[model samples]
Target chain A: MDTVHYLLEGFGTALLPINILFAFIGVLIGTAVGVLPGIGPMSGVALLIPVTASMTGGMDPAAAATSSIILLAGVYYGAMYGGSTTSILLNTPGESSSVVTTLDGYQLARQGRAGSALAIAAIGSFCAGIVSLIGLALLAKPLSEVALKFGPAEYFSLMLLGLAAVSGLAGNSMTKAGIMTIFGLLLSTIGLDNVSGVARFTYNIPALYGGLEFLTVAVGLFALGEVFKTILHKESHDGNLAKVGKILPSKQELKESSGPIARGSLLGFFVGVLPGAGATLASFFSYIMEKKISKTPEKFGKGTIAGVAAPESANNAASGGAMIPLLTLGIPGSGTTAILMGALIMYNIQPGPLLFQDHPGVAWGLIASMFIGNVMLLILNMPLVKVFAKIIETPPKYLIPIIIAISVFGVYAVQVNTFDLILLIICGLAGYYLASNDFPLAPLVLGLVLGPMIENNMRRALTASNGDFMVFLEKPISLAFIVIAVLWIVIPFVLKLKGKKVLINEEA
Target chain B: MSKTFDRYASFIFFIVGMAFMIESGRISHSAYGSNVGPNVFPFLLGLILGLLSIKLFIETMKYQNERKEKEALDYKKFLIILVAAILYALLLEPLGYIISTFLFLLVGFQTIEKGGWVKTVLISASFSFGVYYLFAEVLKGTLPGLPAWFSS
Candidate 1:
């Protein structure tokens, strides 16, 4: 069937009462997750996986997957909208992607235009979401069809490129990021070897045979790790909240932002489609681009409506763009997408070229739900933004502990094992120390999620080639992928050697 | 960062890599039909990790230790909450979800800040009971309920 026909079917599924409710709840929690400082989109989505799992327990596997993903994707983009709320009002970004928004968002809020800034952000985000969804719809079939022709060799190389891209842009130090990636890959090797059915690193430990649980590790690293940071640092929000006056923007204000939103959506969508570059980078790039093209550049960082409009739109669009690589190529470009891929895998639904053909219901349903979820976010944020703003004032005292409780509950509910709970705590400690020391956690998670697939594909390719290592170079597509992967890692290092600053994706 | 932390982490990672490389040899060198073996992937990864750790160590050696202005961490509070979490995990299956969760939250709330005893109790009770009822009762998912003796 054509894309339009499949999309209509997807809308039928998405608009189902349960799926719509899932989207609503997902975006609601997502906005809350974004508004709160301690948790990010990664942790927010991770924490909810098990809860959503149980919530959809009674449904058929296919229906369950659709509903759960609808909610999770809602959280992902809903966060992009909610993040701007804090940036504009508190000058503290709710999530890293919103960091650029604070440049002009806070300035606008200071100028008593907080309401307009927020409204524009919501509008920009809504427009960007629709644009990217349209992009995803147009690109999904073509991209997956191309990916379907890839041999094992090409697949291996492409995945390697994905890993390399993530590690290259992950943190302040590429070496550290590379190490974390390798470490995660090593950790993934602990389970039973899929090909040989031989235990490699299990050492007869029963739990080890299944490998480390991804959900446990994720929650510990992102959720508990952030919690530990809050506890140790004793973070307190003492900044006076900027008063939000006039909920709607003036027509002139809206008119000024139209071009910026459109441009930001296009730029952000392209950036998001590329592996490694994420919403954080997209927002930064769009902001810079807007500044360069703006007739009144001086108005930027001083409450320019375009300033709030561009980056906010860009980040949301970038998130939508990131989904393309994941759904079509089975390569997650960012940390959050990696977690989302893990969730998909948990449902026994692999996200790759075959995903569109095998699970059209899931693929199209998710795309459709994003459209519905974006509307919900725009509607929710427009009137109830003040309620969300109050969430920033939630004392860390109550917030921190409850987060701990939820983490414990979520992990236990899913794994149903004491070992996982213990491991969760240990990972939490490890996550805190590693993150504080500038060891990026995203690459590690990405590596862990992609590790098995990379190894399996490598083995398959080598098996096909009778162990010839040069097979990767023999295939033109594979050779190109490998070259790009090498360039991805090496170019950054070269630029650093020349004292040129390479933009890093801190949100990843 | 911390120079000492990096130095230690690199050293530790080096050991982990070496251990993986050495232990991978225990796995059979070949899978029945494939020319490649299960051990190949981990072995290569371990070797690369070891080399990277060495690189990291050497890089750390070149840095002059700049003492950063350290912020006072709430060690006592953190340690207390951490210990409570550990205990909570340990006692979860034994004491049941509600009791263990309630106790953990109560401890966690008080440890983070001293006041709000009554509010803490209410929240802890509501959350623990609420989740248990919602999950076990409402959703029909399995979670350890009250201990056998207490329930009986």
Candidate 2:
């Protein structure tokens, strides 16, 4: 009952003309970002933060944060919907999460059922979005309530668990991921020390005083890094696009996909709620599950509608599910969510248990906006998918340079200094070389975002215990979190030792 | 993965870790009321990073030597664009937003693919002026306008 009242107020906030316009613009741009191959959701969101910041400059701080977040979250999920279009039409996954959709999506397109495949994907995404939103609304209150009881010790341990979980499943090499995570943490400690107001490792450089701007590093790493890769590799997509015939799926196709959509949504929601497993894993699992249970499993790779439906739904649902931990626990489970968290922090709004109590307008407003955003996505995607498909034809020549321009413009707008611009370029180079060598950039970004909070909590807990480190282990909840963190890292290493191939979440 | 790159990266990371460990010591040891100081966290993280880099170094040694096909990279193009981007950043404030942005985009488009001069000029012009007008004029944001010499 209480949730209902909050949600009603949230609806009132989301329905405001400005907020509605922001949501509309967010999903619209999100679909375009998804349609474009090179820009993933992380880069897309990072690139837009400065733009949104500037656009919302006139609003009151709280309203500004709400509108910016509403738009950004829309982009995050809208990308999931747009990703399937490219996979089906061009045989190219727009983002990593949509990789599995290419398996049957292209085959269905080849059979001239491209329209049905697209319709099913849109419908599945819509259903999954609603399912995950329901789950978020239901779980948000209780989860935050549980988190409210956590002391500094528990928070320190919980953050550690988040770090370990991300590093455990990040990339091909856990060691490399660990190195990146530690490097990010070290980088975070470079600026003024928050605890004692002592400047550490600044070397008297005024730019280093604030530490590395999360926006600068993120834009450099994801956006400019991808651009550099494209330039160096001479990557150009010239695939022939599949033609769209009918705009709707048949009754048989719809009926067959309903079960997969439902099951995928539930499965993906659970996977998403976990710390490390994300949309990529959820989609992969759903695809395999569908194959395993199908009576005619052999038909899966040969253009089964279920193949297109399940993974699409699962990935969308997983993105929705990823929000649970961020909103409630203040821990971002994926790279994109990490960026989102940074955006919220930039607005002086910390997302956590206190987020609901302190700024229900931002939290619930964001939640309510997502419901409207999903509807906008379904409506926009159904008729305008062909228009989005045209986006694939955008020449890499123009796109690449414009992306570079946007990166510079964004960083300059926010930082207004040459130092950050130089740092941005350097980070872009390092990001290219490091990522090319299989060092996952996601954990690095995650570590940078989470590092200060982890240190603060650690110090606070130690302070409470008179400098005894055992305070972390003395508390039952803290001890459990520590044990879980250890196992999260160790279990993956053990699985590799046993010669079993462990699935990694590449998108995260 | 390039074994050479990994080996060099591991070594570089080790040096970075060492630098952090050495530098963190200069920070004051203890805060006024707390036993833990600002220096403690970075020092510990530096130690862990050093250990992880060593592990990465050892892991690189265990990799079996397998010659992989190396794709030809467009280093020339990348270098050109990179230099252009750096110049864009350096000259942005001095040359003002429109001119610097316009010149950068033109160079970028041309470098990526030759020809399409009219299209390139139009796009570059529109983008620079459009963003300047929208952000600075309408949104009331700060961006260096046309150069002082030109305006005067």
Candidate 3:
């Protein structure tokens, strides 16, 4: 009942004309980002952070944070819907989460069922979006309430669990992921110390005082890094697009998809709640589940509507589910959400148990705006599907340079300094080289974002326990979290040793 | 994964870790009302990283010497764009936003694929001017403008 009242108030915040406009623009741009294989949601959100910051420069701080977050979160989920478009039409997934969709979606397109596959994807995404929102609303208060009781020891342990979970599942090798994570944490320590006010790595450099800017590093690694990759290893996306013979799914197709959509929404939401497992993992699992439960499992890869519907629904739901930790526990479950968390931190709006208490407007408004954004995507995608399909034809010659230009403009406009710009380019080069060598970028980002917080809690806990390291084990909840963190890493290792296939997220 | 690259990365990371560990030794040991200080976390993390890098280096030895595939890299095009971008960054303040952005875009678009002069110039000008107009004029955001001599 309290949730209902809060949601209604949330609708009040979300319905403001300005908020609605932000949501519309966010989804619109999100679909385009998803359509462009060069960028994923992580870079998409990172690139827009500065642009949105400047755009909302006029508003009060609270409203500015609310509106921009609504837009960014809209981008996160909207990408899920757009990812399916490429899979069905071009036999290319716009993002990694849609990789499974290509197996059946391209098959469907070959049979002139491209329209059906697309419509089903949109419909499934819409349903999953709604389902996840409801789940978010119901579980948010309880989860945060539970989190509020956690002391510094518990928090330090919990954050460790989060890091371990992500690193364990991030890349092919745990060693590389651990190395990247440690490097990020080390990087985070460069700035002025939050508590002691002593500089660690400045060496008297003025720009180093603020430490390496998260915005600069993220934009360089994900956005410019992608641009450099395209310039060098050029992808030839000149394949013929499947023709759209119909605009809507047939009645039989809808009936075939309804069950898969429901199951996927439920499964994806739970998977999404777990740390480190993101939309890509959710979609893969949902697809496998659908095949297992199907009456004729053999039809899965042969233009079946269930294959198209299940994964699309699952990915969208997982994105929504990913928000649960960010909003409640203040821990980002994946790379995209980590960027989103960074955006929130920029606004001085710490997302955690107190987020609901301190700023109901930002939290609830964001939740309600997602509902509206999902509806906007459905209406916009259905009618303008072909128009968006044309965006795929946007020439690389113009697109590549323009993206580079925007990234430069964005970082410059915010930092207003040449140092960050130079750093951005360097990070971009390193990003390209490292990513190509099977190193996972996500855990490094996750580590960077969580580093200061984890350190703060660890120091606080240690101080309280008089520098006793056993305090982590003394607290029951902290002990449990540490045990789980250990199991999360060890179980994966044991499985790998047994030659069992351990599912890894390629680009979370 | 390239075995050589992995080996070098691990070696480099090990050095970085050791540097952090040794450098942290210079900081104060404790802060007010607490025994733990800022240096503790970084030192611990640096030590962990040193061990992890060794583990990573050891893991690389298990790799088969896979034949290297000579990828057809567009090094000429990439270097051009990279240098252009670095120049744009260095020149952004001195030359101002519009001039630097316009020149960068012009170079970038042409270098990406030559022979779309009219479209490229028009786009570069409009984008540079349009963005400057929107961010500075409309949004009232700060940006370096044309020099007084140039404006006159």
Q: Which candidate is the best by DockQ?
A: 2
Better of 2 and 3 by DockQ: 2
Could you tell me every candidate's TM-score relative to the true structure?
Answer: 0.99, 0.99, 0.99
Ranked by DockQ from best down, the candidates are: 2, 1, 3
Off by over 4 Å in 3: none
- lDDT (tens digit, per residue) of candidate 3 on A1-508: 9899999999999999999999999999999999988889989999999999998998998899999999999888888889899999999999999999999999999999998899999999999999999999999999999999999999999999989988998989999998988898899999899999998889999999998889889999999999999999877699998996697988999999999999999999988999999899999999999999899999989889999999999999999999999999999889999999999988989998899999999999999999999999999999899898998999999998898888998898889899999999998998998899988888888888889999999999999999999999999999999999999999999999999999999856
lDDT, candidate 2, equals: 0.94
| Deviation (Å) of A372 in candidate 2 | 0.5
RMSD of 1: 0.8
Cα lDDT of model 3 by residue, B38-139, tens digit: 899999999999999999899999999989878999999999999999999999999999999999999999998999799999999999999999999999
Off by over 4 Å in 1: none
Q: Which pairs of residues collide in candidate 2?
A: none
CAPRI-style grade of the A/B interface in model 3: high
For residues A1-508, write the lDDT of model 2, one tens digit per residue: 9899998899999999999999999999899999899899999999999999999999999999999999999999999888999999999999888999999999999999999999999999999999999999999999999999999999999999999999999999999999999999998898999889999999899999999999999999999999999999988788889997687999999999999999999998899999889999999999999999999999988899999999999999999999999999999999999999999999999988999999999989998999999999989888988899999999999999999999998998888999999999999998899899999999999999998999999999999999899999999999999999999999989999999999999987
- Taken over the whole model, the C-alpha lDDT of each candidate is 0.95, 0.94, 0.93
Worst 10 residues of 1 chain A by lDDT: A231-240
